[model samples]
Target: MKLAENMLFKYGSGKVIRVLYINPFTSIIYVIDMDSNRWSYPIPKDDFLTAYQNKEMIEENDDIYCRAVPEEELNELEKQKRDQAWEIVTFFKSKLSDDEHMFISKYRQKAMKETMAVFSISYNGLKNILIKYFKGSQTKCSLIPSYFRSGARGKERKAGNKKRGRPRKNGENAGVNIDENIKKVFKIGLNRYYYNTRKNSLKTTYELILKDFFVKEVIDENGVKIPVLNNVKDLPTYEQFLYWFRKSLNDGKREIIKREGTRVYQQNYRAIIGSSTQDAELGPGTLFQIDSTIFDCHLVSSFNRDIIVSRPILFLIMDVYSRLIVGFNITFESLNSYSGAMVALANSMTSKKELCKKYGIEIEDNEFPFCVPNRILSDRGELVNGYINGSIQNLGIIIQQTPAYHADYKGIIEQAFNQTNIKILPFVDGAVIGGNSKRERGEGLDYRLKSSMTIEDFTKVIIKSILFHNNHHVLSDYILEESMIENNVEKIPIRLWEHGLKYKKGQLRILPEEVIKTSLLPSQSGLITPKGLSFKKMLYASKYALENNWFQMARIKGNWKVKVCYNPTDLTDVLVFDEHGDGPFKFSLLEHLSMYSGKGESEIEQIKNFERELERTGKERELQEKMKLFTEIEDIVKEAREKTEAEKNYSKSNSRRLKGIKENQKNERLLHREKAKKEREMEVILDESIEEEDEFAMFRDWEESNDDE
Candidate 1:
């Protein structure tokens, strides 16, 4: 056995390439470029003849003779020596039978024995050399020998330059260059008997497990040295313990459970009694929910003022407990934000008395109980939301912004607006209710003012109508049936009282006469006389409602208009003036009567009859007026004379004939009376005379007596 020629090559500058292999049977070792996959000097026939061979190579107990035998040596000609040697020999014999084939046949057997090729050297040296060779050379074989290395290096350099430009200088010292890519290696071991044992199949060596390590040597049951191996599975059967353990070393958790797989339970949140709920006992003016809605009243637009027809905004404060709309404002413009809405809210929040004094509205104490409201609740409209989010605390009012889009949060106010706008406003034909769209009929001034009536006239109509609605329209609690049942009707009752209201009982408190009398003052005594104020040539009541420092609240012009309501307990009484210290006028009930005028014969006759009645009473002025009325009537009849003298004469003749017939009837009546008197006298004479005188004489005497009488 002997070592063959060895070479070290550098493809580019400062790059060492080594080829290494081991012939285990011959104890021969080959060292070459580590980067190149090829061995130096075609490996060797054996290590017994290398320049580096020593006593260690010759005294090895492993089969060194296998490399020493010429017949067992490998030929460098074939790429694969085991199966292709015979094929290579046959090909050479056929192609070169002349001189080349004969020369090859003579030394083929010797070359085959001389080359028992393999890789050898320390793992570090092998890796370093391989790195250097691959970094510089393209072909693994080119890094093995000088001849192949020179040719391959030229081609790679030229190609690389063409592709990537000329090579640039890298700062590395050639002789002692360190390859950073080199990885550490471990030694695999086997027992002598197992390593030398005969085998039918190729065995792959498995890396040492716990079995290879002997923490401390121990004697077996038979006093033999033995090592320990932990064979039991360390985890539950469901999991791969080793796999999870290895991952846990890197990930810190043995079991990686995704958050998506975990269930999260949420807590139930209920309004707390002393917190979200009211702590104080509810009373009148305890709570008010302020909000705005578009009222349904529609009006026509005046000519030339035809802006985009818009529904007016109606802002109102409703008593939550009572469901009463306490204070409200009707505007012909959209609210847009909290500016106007807050104005309405402030107005609604103040007591009617305070408000009247402040705003100069003549509202009374009774109205105070009706108008003053407490806490305000509202949905998250921009105005309500802004108030809640901004400066509500400064106003000293509790504001609760209803959850977005949840109508039930402010159900009471919402329902109040609905009932007020939808139910009541539609009845008035030309009412322009604020907070409603103007798209429908009867919405604007053009529709409302087109009538003969003025805005003031329409205001009167609106006040009367709205009063009727408020007094007569039955209000209901704004709560679901389920809530009602849960509270056992107590919640509704409390809420109603807080809003300053009560539902009507089915039975009336008194008889119809009493009801009417109590409802309205008597016509004569204690009558509220309307002071005359002329408008459009017609005298109307001034609505001097607030008097003696008293306030009277009433709806005027679709708004809450206040006046001083007064009454004087006397018929034909005049309203007193504090400034003059005297009565203003003889304002009586007659002022309230409906005014009318008439024409034609029927009207004239009525006047004549009225004057006659006055004359009988001996009213001097009335009597004079009656005489004047009669004279006027006679003149009118005389003025209706027939045309032409012949028609006049005919009328006169007809009148005379009628007169003659009347006189003739009267004369006949007188003659009949005389005849009746004569008959009575003759009867008495015949009784006295009796049987004497003949029948004929008696008959003649009777006839004569009748004639004479």
Candidate 2:
């Protein structure tokens, strides 16, 4: 694709530049570099296309680019906001001169900028106050802000199409009645549009609006009335009802406001949808719920144990029908699909026996589950584009993406998260109240400052929460929660899970370990070179992978895209599946990743970014230069310990990540030692007659004896 506004590109100064504004006339793009420095540079179209072709630049995923401001600048902004917020309000009050402060609604939205130009207040600090104070909230005799405009559509419509009076009523339809019949239809349509949890279309709402207005009979909002309209002859046109339905009686923005207020209406508005009592034919492995939420608790560094850090992210997967959590992961790492898919795959394949043991959770044999769901119901996040979606598709699992904000689609899991958090947070130190402040009881009690729980302990708490939620907490699906115990049916989510396992219609498919590993890990189509599998700008091979000169034979496959799946958590190994000319597809691990053995996926990303910068300057850095760059990064981090470290957010995140890498490397070393010991010990008896000779004794003699050349 050609260069455009908001596209991310590599610059010659070794910076990743994000395009802020592009001027087509001058071919100049205003960009903010990674260091938060701005630049306006002109480039020819040919060069932009060339950069794309060479993969030196990339397009935006979300169509919006942003830059971090310098910390000093951010601090100054906050200071100004604190100091001048009320001053600007006073300035506006003086300008008002006792009369209500009148301005165009358009002007009101942009008032902060104008105020910033005059009195200089921080937008972040003043935003909430501005909304309340200006919108006529009388806080201690403060002047109210009021506005006049065409109608609700003033913002969505073009300035040219604007009319003087209310725009909702098509100029001729002003005499519409709010009679019982009309009001019934109006509400039916309105509920579907704004109130109902279902994602309804305007066409459907319009049809319902017209039909109820003409054909159907229903009670009005008032109990005493039937037909509020005195005459059927005087009733408005079908077209007019359609207009009013869209308009919501001159407040068409009502629907827009509610929708914008909460993007996931499914969870937030499930009661309106009436899904709290509706039960689908669901069981274990029917629908998997996957989502990521930052924990409400703070954490400390693993080594230091005193320094505070930000909340770690929890990626959860649950069985919707049984209300049982299937798999989950807790990491101080960045929230992304990498962690999301890992948890999804683990939920499908890995048992929680080891996890429960580590976390000190006691559960009955059937309390927890490891069943692959038939469908994955999730938002259209990066996880959908990740390996989980494709891998599940191969296993015939339908992936369902609900309309954004429709929480009812995954209500059970949503409620599960809330219940889990509520039960777990109070006992833990440094826990944020998550909008419910009852748990916290102190002044100057910064939860972020009070952090003492390590990531591991936080994980233990989370695991314990999930187990308690699944096994002990009584689920109230399709019934009143209070009545669940009185109903005398199966209560616990695990009981429901056990029942589902025995009676659930769908059969579970268990995949092989190799298949799970191959499918779950991030993969690329690689070419098998003579040395090894050439992948991700690096080569990897194992002794077994190179057995019988398979690498050389792999080239004969010719044009076939060899599938290679590598764990980002460990770049030292990549599992490869390749079909050469003669034999079946061979599955092998390419363990020798050269000097990249101990690198994490994030570090690999760093290297790719560094390479992109070097490529932009028409130069290539060798392995030594690349290693030097990493050293510089390390030195920068070391310097940051004393000079730049504030709270433990980034530091703990980085430390936890490095700790994971070291642990993985440590395991890798142990595995190598074990592998060598196994090689020295492995022996096969040649003949039955020779079986008399002890293989152990022969091996021992061979180990003790030195051979002459």
Candidate 3:
């Protein structure tokens, strides 16, 4: 290799040197030892070339040997040091001429001392700066202070009997050395007092340590227990306590979780690495976030306007890339169950035309596009179920469940809920405002009583809100791609979605509506009984089952179980998949159970419970009535037996008593018929007599009035 200035070479013994100056006229080279930052003796050019050729010396890249620090990473002190060094080096170089430069390269003590005095820098400092400048290719960054290496990071120092750190001032006693025993005490105190939800400050924890570990209780002469502190000189100081506390609990996450509650820390204190859309999503439909929140307003029942239905749970599915709310479901179903999540997911993958039409809202196809996402992110709620995971996976969709207590993982949907509420809730009647404390203090009218909108009406309003959000609402903080900017696309959800479809396509997968419904609908095992398909204690029938005589076969061969999928929000029909690959078919409720036709799962359960309670009460009343009738029969039997016992010695033989039994029975029946006819005649005569008396009295009063006139 050709020798040049600032070139590095490593000797056979592994000592590295940088070429400071090369003199072709004298056939000599000047270099400096990089490790010691000192000048080395001059070497003959021929000898150096021989060593390099013989493999006794190897050429090294200066970049590997020289340290370069970024200016931004430098602290104030480091920057000042670097500037000072650069100024000194610049002044020294300005003073040197071409002749003096070569002379100084040979480590001339007289010239170096004179220059150092002029520059107000020590001789060694000047020499070190010169070595660094040449070795680092004369870059200003090479002079940055390496204070990071000053304290010997990662190197443990053994503590001596003397205190290791700075001593106290104000004539205070010097603190004792912290040994293994003292470290143990510090750990115990920290664990007991500091790392807990109590949130004790460092000083409070140190005081607690002093009180508990460094003080002893003594009985005074007055028979009172008094606390006595240990010698101040022998006790560990507060600084040592804090230092060891941080060192012992070095993991930030663990410390946060211990200091605060896990839930609080995760919700408030945990570091957010990056947004899901920017960090993980590629384009629209690549990733979707699904979450559910309780709606802020109460709603009236659609059937009974007087009844107030509690707040409905709003399930939203938003595209992570475009922040477009692809689908949503508003229902009374709770967020804990997978029912609402499944419905929301199914809605997300299917067309929203019917949904919008049902709510009487019109929208274009492009306004709310429905497409299956490659991955769906959700909290550890509904979508975290094993069955849901399997079902979604079968559709070639990946399920990403967020860590426990980490709701921010699906923050896109969470934010959408908040935004939707903020836009519409203010105008809605019965909207929940402020915290529960306000309600407890009776600040306003009862929200439940003020509710006026039904679920359907509220759903329509939400659809309108969503439409506005998708098409017209501007996303001020939305990040745009270079292509979007070039095309002058507006920062709106619909525009972003349209652009994504045109440019970044293929992330969206479209399946048939029926397929998506069957896959995402919540499923449960139903029994095929003689009555019908028994599910949730409700009987259902299908045309296929009727034609195949499934019920008839079940009647003969006992009931069997099969997996069935159903929409919990509407239990009128369920889906049963055929094992022989005929596809899933709908099972409608049996005609005999028409009362439960439009009822949901929870409503049906409640109705069944009410009916059961009624049956139990009716059975109890029937038992009481039957007991009273039996008591009357017993009384009649006793009266007849008493009359027989009172009769004097008059006994009829069994044959005599039985003789003419048929004739006697006929006579008795005729007499009873005659008696009933006479009683009916008397009742009719009495009613006629009462009517005639009233008529005669009216006539008499009219005649008297006429005579008086």
Query: lDDT per residue, candidate 1, 1-709, as tens digits?
Result: 3211122333333334332333334443434444344433333534324422443322222211111111111123211332232233233334442311122324433332322222323444433333333222211221232222122222212222132323335732111111111101111122211232332111221223223431346798999986653323211111222322232222211111121111211112211112212421243445566677654444323221322223445676655444444555444445534443554554454444643443334545333334222245565573444323323322223455555566666665566566555654555454454533234675435444322332222333333333333344445433533534454444333343423222211111111111111112111112222333222222323334334311222222122211111121111222322221112222222344332121112222334455577676778777789899999998877766533443555546776757778789999999999999999999988976665556668899999999999
C-alpha lDDT values of all predictions:
0.36, 0.54, 0.74
Query: What is candidate 1's CA lDDT for residue 14?
Result: 35
Candidate 3 Cα lDDT to native: 0.74
| Per-residue alpha-carbon lDDT of candidate 2 for residues 517-601, written as tens digits (9 for 90 to 100) | 5545555677767766677777766565666675667667543356666655445656665542111133433445444554445
Which candidate number has the best TM-score?
A: 3
Ranking by TM-score: 3, 2, 1
Query: What shift in Å separates residue 617 of candidate 3 from its native position after superposition?
Result: 5.3
> Model 3 over residues 39-120: C-alpha lDDT tens digits?
5567888998999999998987533544422222344556567768877766665565542263354435655666788877
The 10-residue segment of model 3 with minimum total lDDT is 65-74
Using lDDT as the measure, name the better of candidate 1 and candidate 2. Answer: 2
Best by lDDT: 3
Which ranges in model 3 have alpha carbons more than 4 Å from their true place?
1-274, 279-282, 298-311, 331-336, 355-365, 401-409, 427-430, 437-461, 482-488, 579-582, 592-598, 613-650, 683-699
Query: Any runs in candidate 2 off by more than 4 Å, and if so which?
Result: 1-279, 301-309, 332-339, 354-365, 382-390, 434-445, 476-489, 524-543, 546-563, 567-574, 578-709
Q: What TM-score goes with each of the models?
A: 0.26, 0.38, 0.54
